[model samples]
Target: MDETQPLLPDPDLACDEAQDEAAGKDFVDFDPAGDAENPMDWPEAYKWGIVGLLALMAFTVTFTCISVVPVATRIVDDLDGGHASRSASVLLVTIWELGEAAGPLLIAPLSEMFGRYPVMNAANLLFIAAVVLAALSRSAAAFIGARALTGLAVASNVLNPAIVGDMFPSEQRGTAMSWIQLAPLIGGAVGPAISGAIAETLGWRNVLWMSATLAITCEAVFLTCFRETYKVAILRRRAARLRRETGDPALRTVFDVEGVSRSQKLWEAITRPFSVLAGSGVLQSLSVFGAVSFAYFYIMATTLPDILETLYGLSAAAAGSALISFSIGSLVSVAICNRALDGIYVRMRDANKGVGQPEYRLPLLVFGGFALPLVASLYGWTARAHLPVPLLIFTVGVMGATMLLSFLPLTAYVVDAFGLYAASAMTVVIVTRCLAGTFIPLASERLVDRFGYGVGLSLIGCFSLLFAPIPALVLRYGPKWRQRSRYTREAEAS
Candidate 1:
């Protein structure tokens, strides 16, 4: 290979693609993003292993956030609060998720710089320490700080889908990534129920101790098992090795495009997530709905313990047990939808003569979108009406079904719509909804106080109604918008 010959025209450079088209060079630049050595070509077993470990990590972090909800009363007492104690107590969950949301914007770039394994391992270790800090905290401020510290694992939350995108073909990605996507909802639903029992038998601090032990065990397994899979970082290492062996300073990876400084690329990467977030209509509608539903989930998860104990006269453990309904609902949705997701997309692509459009992912939203308002209305109004405890629990479960269903179609759509920029797009959705989740629960006790559960939830139910037709509207109008979109074309091709 001639070191001086300009590296095969970099197709990743849109400008170069245009120039080559006009010059009739018939040369396609090497694209490390999708080369034969692409991470997608890695063995399926290896990819599944990575997904499994990442799922375990995601489950751990999510559990840390929600398990504490069942113990909110104990935590408030432990912190020795005043009149405002209960509200302060529940802030723990919100603060922790806030950390989860913000961690990626600051830490994700390091993963891009170093590699996923090192950052993940390092973040896992830091996460354990944060759990320890939460366990030992003597004051509310200390506990809040520690909970935010756990947000260091935000990379796991934001990056897993990007990993899915990197490793799986577009057609098969929804099915494969469903395993990763499903973990959070399951983990979120499981923790409060089980932790309530653990809090009863052991203590609240022991809940943190239990979670720390889980995190440590998963970290040990992951450290021993997983390797880096980000293709650019992998190729950079390979290029460095060759440069060292051949004593040719010019040997470079495909990522080494002329005139694109490392800082410039990093700046672009840092800022592009927001740019894509702000620039796209498709992203805006999906993200707004995601944020609202997610906020609804947090409100429900954080408040259920209180709701059950106060209204149904259930014990702390029994109150936590109510989460079983939520967890079961989410699982049922994933089981049914994951099977249908890929088939729907593939059929649409086949119908279009092998040209794939992101809208193929929208039809499933027909079921999901309707489920949101329908269940929110029932859950909200029925709870407010002081219906039978069993009936209320059943309605909560129904809401869980709607919650998970609502999330899946939009997630698959965004992933297909954004492609290589999926991380940025996802980060936008995460940050927006997480902030909403963080603040909305703070108002939960107040909302129930002013409006009562029935009316308060009905308001939320009505909100859910607004976005229900999004899939249909997008299906009809999305192609026209995509024509005007700067990111949509790049996303589809990638």
Candidate 2:
């Protein structure tokens, strides 16, 4: 029970003794907690190399997601004869998010069954092909379709959290999670910041070509460097090897002893996110709040360029440069949260008699919930009043930091709550947020046109305030709700 050591159980000891006894003597697992094969026991430098690669992959996928925002108008003008409706133009940007929402359903389960290495590399290859199609597209429909395919193929965004869970202990995960989660936020911000200039100088197709290049590079590194990390998948491979070496068909891992077919496990894995969402009130609340955060973030990302153009007469490139404030704010949030998250969690666990609960991750979330409204209101009203551009930029930075404050803790909570099924649990959050990202920004332009920036944004702030109590409620009631959830209970038992 060394304080610095990971809390993972020895794979052999975790199996039911009676089940192993009844099944006969030949079985295979990592017998010692410090087994080199255990992902958590890998050399620190090696583990961090994997994390850096995953972070890069996460950055690439999300960078593609938002990179087109600054160039949406140019795209429509070139591809649609400048006659497409506002909704239709917006669809080109948002459709990618819809594809993101759909990908995790199959990818999460497949990764669980096979392993992270194969599933991720296969998806990365598809991602590169889709990006190439997008670059070659000449029509709006073709381009939207390509973007959607790319989103569907980008599995790293959803899978990275689970990979982090596989490799790091709970108390040590905060800094790594910050890197993974911050990549998307920074990517989403940096994408639009540079893309406007790229589109203006090179054209919209070149933006996609740039994305394709990044995708290709990421795939090359990932395939060559990443290895299998999922413990079940690793153990199953070991068991199969042992059976061959010893000539004993009786040799098994726990998965083999369970007597479940691959198809059945895949089917259940596909549906488990929905089941977990439907059954767990904690998940339901988190999804709602997470969706709100995503919607607000995307609404700003999709609308800011136009808003700045209209309100301040800024050029597209200048407006896009303004978004670099968001990247700056995200870096600041990472500095603050990375230093505070694990320290706070450890202190709270000690206070709770040296036991950790998922709710311990909620303190930062509660702070974020209240801060979101203030920043949203400020962002809206400043633009409405034609305030100084620097002031408006400052508000955007605050908004960016506040969003991550809510996002990082929410992610950490789900990973902690649903240990074995972290990927599936994370799917619930990603799918919900991506759905919100797809649809919410579609209405933002209209809302601004009708209500003005102040009223429209204040309305969003009000909606956020309504759900701001969610983390607090979960903190109070989560344990009882977890006890009632078959999914959470099963996760805990495993």
Candidate 3:
């Protein structure tokens, strides 16, 4: 084979393991004979194409996460197992987030043990089936069950960063990560916009059907475009092939370098997140801050329709249309992040004697931390006062922009902080985030009812104010902590 030829010529990878000891023989399992078999050695076009597909997958799963919000009332009426309150009906959203919090705990480890493809494809299929069940549901339990399953499946998207790290070197990771960051927000934003319109015109069930269609479309794209990005899965295939070709059961891969067994690997994959999360003050603080911020973000997002509908008396479709501003704001904010995030990191690195640290991502968050809460308060109070349509939308837009300003950097910071274990660290981020999404907003409805939109939103914004110092703390003290820890020190040393 030509040294330059792509190791993964197809999406399906044939990988391997090893038990070789001859000084002249290849002893490394799935060893890159040169740079040829390394994921980083793939052509840029292939790397980026894979990134695009992964982003689409993330978007599809996230879109389903909140798509039901616009039609919560309709679902309540259509499937009355008993007298479920409006709030109780909308708890389905929380149910989904609940599932998301646990899904990564189970699926991500399996993805490590097996491969990303089998896990991801199976999850996507379950998501599709869940959507159908939601659409055809005859009782609240069935629909809520489906929503929880959907949440569980969607958590797979949280692992996409591992693939980015697998393919892109540190220099190119920021831009690609920024793009992946947009998927969840964009998916969350667009879902209600389309679902509200569909529910108003076609029926509530069509909202789920539309989401199902999107799942199908994204899965097709995934099947065609994404190769097995997991190193173990790829090398395991290679090891298997080598064993078959040479009839040597003695062959093994480098994963055997430490004599780690399948059970031990599985145990490590499962327990590491919790242990690391508990051990690292950095991960703990980041998880809490990220969770609260995201909870409030979703609180604002899911409740916007309710606010607009109650305060301004807009129709379902109009309220949905109003949400376009949020989506627009989120999309524009991501574009800015994609363009500026890497530039900022590169510039700061250049100015600091060619040094790079995760904290370099913090300066943007400093601005975001203070600005987002203030603007979010404005959005809340403006909605409370029933302010002019233009002003409300603009305030919400600014909130969207500031939200991503902090949100995008935090994920990148964790990726940089954890390096090879970015996926494990990300599980904590995802779990904290989903916990917030699942629970915090459950109170928003009552909060708004009691204090009105302005006061309620201001309350949430106050929490943002409280957590604002997190990035700065990490910026100032993060290096020392990294030096103390094994994982991040490895990142820094490398």
Candidate 4:
């Protein structure tokens, strides 16, 4: 390794854990001070500034995925000789989710191999190129390909939390996570209206162009401002460089002092997340709940426009604006959860004789879960008969319920249980949800045809109800469940 020449290769800017019965050895240890430049050790203002920038990065990526699709319906129709099939339109909506689902699973692990900054910036730039291709797309196939490319490139959703976790301590992390979570929810709620308005005013191609411009601008900012945060990885790289350049056999890395390495560590870094997910019952339980809730949200996002536009005869813009109600619902739930979840955690911790687990975050789950199904049923029945907009807004309330109850549990549980692998655990959850999101647009029309909106939505509601008890059961038995995991016990002990 060279002192000045980078340790990890340029193409792969590059980047490790362990156990019991191995006395006098750390299970997992890495340098605390990395690269003289790890953002985790940056000044407070610097860290928070990166957080804000990343938040916008998140906003740009997410808003692009979600917002541009609705407006794309017009383009699809125009391309299809001015008569795109309803199902075809849904494919356009849902296929982007397929790309989203794939991106995190495929690309997130690369962060360990490469540094986080490089991976994130590269992905955003790729996403910008995809949007450019999308803007120039002449056929539906080209457009869908571009969408998938964009999705794959910007799979930053999984890594965003990891970035934040690196910046904040556990106790104060919820506030940061909460704010991060809000961006996607707001993006989902507002994307369609923005896109729809843009499409209706300018040609549909301009929507893609606008998204590309945003992506490029954001990418530029990230390249200019972002810093690497994975501490151990950076130190390992630094040590490797020092060894190569100086060629001192006695040369030791900061990581050597802390006992981390980058040589064979890359595979462990990539695979360990799955190992943690498989080994932890708590992760499994929380993942299921979170994934299902996420799936329902995607389903709603895919179907809501169809419901309003077709059934209510609302214009594209009006139907898109209806998502504002969903946005309101999400905001309301976020407000309620932020105010109350912490209080409940403290009270529960006190009641438990000064110790608490992630399960304490589940109280709102019961309220949110049960209420959503009932709300769905009400929305279905009323809307089936052409009820007032207020009735539809009430359905937004049900959707809001899901957000309120699920967000805290999902974010907190992974943070509590998997700790370092929270991003990976969230990856699993996002995969399932994004899959559901992709499927909904493909199937929404068929579902309504076969059973009508009343039945189809009611069915989704029932499924939600079935999964609602998940968090409740976890809250009840979470501690005992956690005791069975070697990792959880070790994290708690520390």
Q: Pick the candidate with the highest lDDT.
A: 2
lDDT of 3 by residue, 162-237 (tens): 6776777655677898788778667877777777888877888877888899999988877777677777677768
lDDT, residue 245, candidate 1 = 85
Query: Once superposed on the true structure, which residue ranges of model 4 sit more than 4 Å away at CA?
Result: 1-41, 241-270, 350-356, 440-444
Candidate 2, poorest ten consecutive residues by summed lDDT: 1-10
Task: Give the Å error, residue 204, model 1.
Answer: 0.4
Superposition error at 157 for model 3 (Å)? 2.7
Tens-digit lDDT track of model 4 for 1-494: 11111112221122221122124232232435542365545688887777678778777876787775555567677877787776767777677778887887656567756768778877877888888888888887778888877777865677777776666654555566666656666776777788788777876777677777877888888888888776546655665676678775554432342333655455555565576678888777667666566655555665677677777777777777777777677777776766776667778778888775666667877676667666766766777888887778678766766665665556665665555455667677767667867775355457667887788778777776777887778778877887787546534311
Q: Each model's TM-score, in the order given?
A: 0.90, 0.93, 0.90, 0.85
Worst 10 residues of 3 by lDDT: 1-10
Task: List lDDT for all candidates, in order.
Answer: 0.74, 0.80, 0.74, 0.66
**Distance from true position, residue 212, model 2, in Å?**
0.7
Off by over 4 Å in 1: 1-37, 81-84, 258-264
User: What are the clash counts of all predictions, listed in order?
Assistant: 2, 0, 18, 8
Instruction: Please write out the lDDT profile of model 2 over residues 227-247, one tens digit for every residue.
Output: 898887888899889888988
How do the residues 274-350 of candidate 1 rate in per-residue lDDT, one tens digit apiece? 77777898888888878777777777877777778887788888887788788778777787678988888888888
Model 4 residue 452 CA deviation in Å = 1.4
Residue 361, candidate 1: Cα error in Å is: 1.3
What would you estimate as the lDDT of candidate 1? 0.74
How well does model 2 score by local distance difference test?
Answer: 0.80
